[model samples]
Target chain A: MLNPTITEILLSLMQVSYITLIVLVVSAICGLILGTILTIIVVKKIPVLKQITVTFSSFTRSVPIIIQLFIVFYALPPVIESMGFSTTYITATVASIVALSLYHGGYLVEVFRAAYRALDKGQHEAADSMGYTPIQKFRRITLPQTIPVALPGWGNALIHLIHDTSLVFALGVVDIMGRGQLIAASSYGMNQVKIFLIIAAIYIVLTFLSDAIIRFFEKKNKKFKLDSGLNTKGA
Target chain B: MNFLILFEDFVQLLAVVPQTLLLAITIFILSILIGTVMALIQEYNVPVLKLIVVIVKLLLRGTPLIVLIFLMYYSLPDTVTFLSGLVGLDYNGTNIPPAIILIVAVSFTVASFQAETIRGSFLSINKGQIEAAQSLGYTPYQMFKKIIAPQALVEAIPEFSSSFLIVMKAISLGFMITVVDIFAEARLIATDNSYYVEAFFAAALMYWAISAITVTLSSKYEEYLHSRM
Candidate 1:
């Protein structure tokens, strides 16, 4: 009773889930890698590089994701084509993933950098005094500690990226919103309202799921703290 | 990569500044006015209105802005017309402008976030200050006007400035619904000239510059407020 095109709605849901999962994985991986690198650069105070990272982060943060998507989707192909790369590979999905990952990566950089900055100066001093290598210090102390600090912001970023996936439909990608568009078009807009309301509900469920997952991690972190008598401060 | 071409592109993008500003400023003002009311309701804990505000805030925050705009611009009219027909009323709801729909959708989202920001600022005001004002024989309105309002307004400025930048970026979404803002204008020029990169690069620069100026101004204002304190 939601809409006459229940099957289309289901298909769109599947498509939406598919796109969201891909985007989530792609953006998470890209964001983490890039964010970590940027955080490290900042932590080390790499002369001009730190300034560059800061500027890049602020610029990316300021730009709208939709504008970024359009720029990448339309502009990137021509640039790639000029570089002797085929533009055929840059579909709407690819453009969406690229733009979304980069956008999320900028935010993740802030989260990761802030988390690093929040750690007590004594932690680094202790590691240094113990003759721990920089890599060892990062792996054994910083990485583990930063996770709890970064989790909430990282979770919010992922949820935001998921919400942004709905915009891929604007690029003609058959995401949930695109699916709604398709169904509305096919049904001559008879069920547009129902289709969109259903899509909104789906988004709500996705965001709630992400929040719950973050809560689960928070609880686990709390339990770990209680057992080990170690606490990671939230900044 | 041509400097002259890029300059031309920047000009084309700049030409649409008026429309972009109109969209951003209009929605921002509406959102702040409406958002303040919504925030005050939650602040005072009005029974039914508080519940409704919570629900509305959640609904707005949970859904993507694009979905809201799409629904308002496209689906709402058909649904309205159909409902009206069922009640034996002849109404055509399709004549509303996309700009108006964009405003409504963007304002709803902005208001939700603004309500939260405004509420936080309100909560940050200490009870002792209000008590002091009360002891001075100040009316409730006078208490708000003289003490609570000043502190909250100063506190709210930093957050409000960032939201102002956000509203500016959001105006780009109006392009999706064909509202002829700067983003839309850039897209048109890019399509016409087939220089997508140059056109969009110009658009990005303009957006970045506006936001950068906003950040600088906001920080300066915040410093001035702190100096006053």
Candidate 2:
């Protein structure tokens, strides 16, 4: 029955941005590391570990992220406590980051693996001929190429992650969605649609901004590669 | 980790499988129907509707589905009342079910994704074939039916399956709206059994099983399609 003021809407949007920023930054960093590790484990085909990692990735990928969120938020602490670990300090935000990173990391592993597979065998051979060690070859040759190829998919994962951060509200995190609910609740259940429409618009703008940023990097990467003259068959 | 409790919870959660599956099926069918229309509109490049389609796609795809769900579940009655008022009709608009609202919200988001998939397939259709069809004096409908649909369908199948999986995963969010889907059932079981970990684990297994089956079926269907080609 009450309209949210311009200031209230703007303030809520700002708060949402802060929460989203935290989740995105944390998930992106942790997911990249986790994904890379999973990719390597699979690619190197480690005994037992490879199969286990593959299954874990597959399972995580198949299940909904919200389910994963619930597991991490609710199930994991008890499981951890049963194993003699304390999780008293694991707040909702931490749970959200952990769940989201794991969820996105599963997809990122596929992207990294596929990008690595797409590279020509000659690249590896060339690195080997140069007396480069495995790690050195990966650092100097493999990563550079894989990054460009994986960037678009990674960008998509980031966008998806951005949308998913809203689900943190289900954990009662007072994120943007939570704030919208609060606004609606304060209005005695009125203006629910109007408030959410505004919030959704803000999200659309955020999504557009992320897309533009990713596109800009993609273009810059292309230009940098062409100028460096590594633009061979891989290019 | 009580086995008996987990088993009981699993059985209880199983009862909601039909609701979950029906929601997924309804959303999948409606989204595909809407997606096909959007794709066709894009193909024709209808002036005003094309702009609206692009805007709708961006809006739906850009926003999180939960927000849309809240919008739909909370706003539909008000919207109905407003519309009815404009038309001079008496309406209270309170009998709508949450499941229907969830389906409509999720379908709007999924339809945008499906539209993109269909549009990509349409874009992949050969320009030369279209020109040849035109030279043969084929109408737009005839050209689409004979020359475009089959080719696009082949290209679209993989994306369609992926979208189908997405729709399946998405309905789990319906639990947030208290739709009594399996996920919601799991929460209730957890509250009742006080074994949150075990209850959620059982639910996860169920979700994983459905997803695995869908993936297997899609791959097999893809193989069959390839064999025909």
In TM-score terms, which candidate is top?
Answer: 2
Backbone clashes, each candidate:
0, 0
TM-score of each: 0.90, 0.92
**Highest-lDDT candidate:** 2
Residues forming the 10-long window of minimal summed lDDT in candidate 1 chain A: A223-232
lDDT tens string, model 1, A1-235? 3357666676666766777677667877887788888888888999999999998888688888887888788777878999999889889888888888788888888888776766667778889999999999989877767777678788878777877887877788876677677777777767776777888888888778878988899777653232122353632
lDDT of each: 0.81, 0.83
Q: List the residue pairs that clash in candidate 1.
A: none
Regions of candidate 1 where Cα sits further than 4 Å from its true position: A1-8, A78-87, A223-235, B75-92
True contacts kept of 1: 0.67
Instruction: Compute the lDDT of residue A67 as modeled in candidate 2.
Output: 82
lDDT by residue (tens digit), candidate 2, B4-75: 877887888889888788888899999989999998889788999999999898788789888889888888
lDDT of 1 by residue, B17-100 (tens): 877888898999999988999998987889999999999887876798888887788766777789999999999868767888
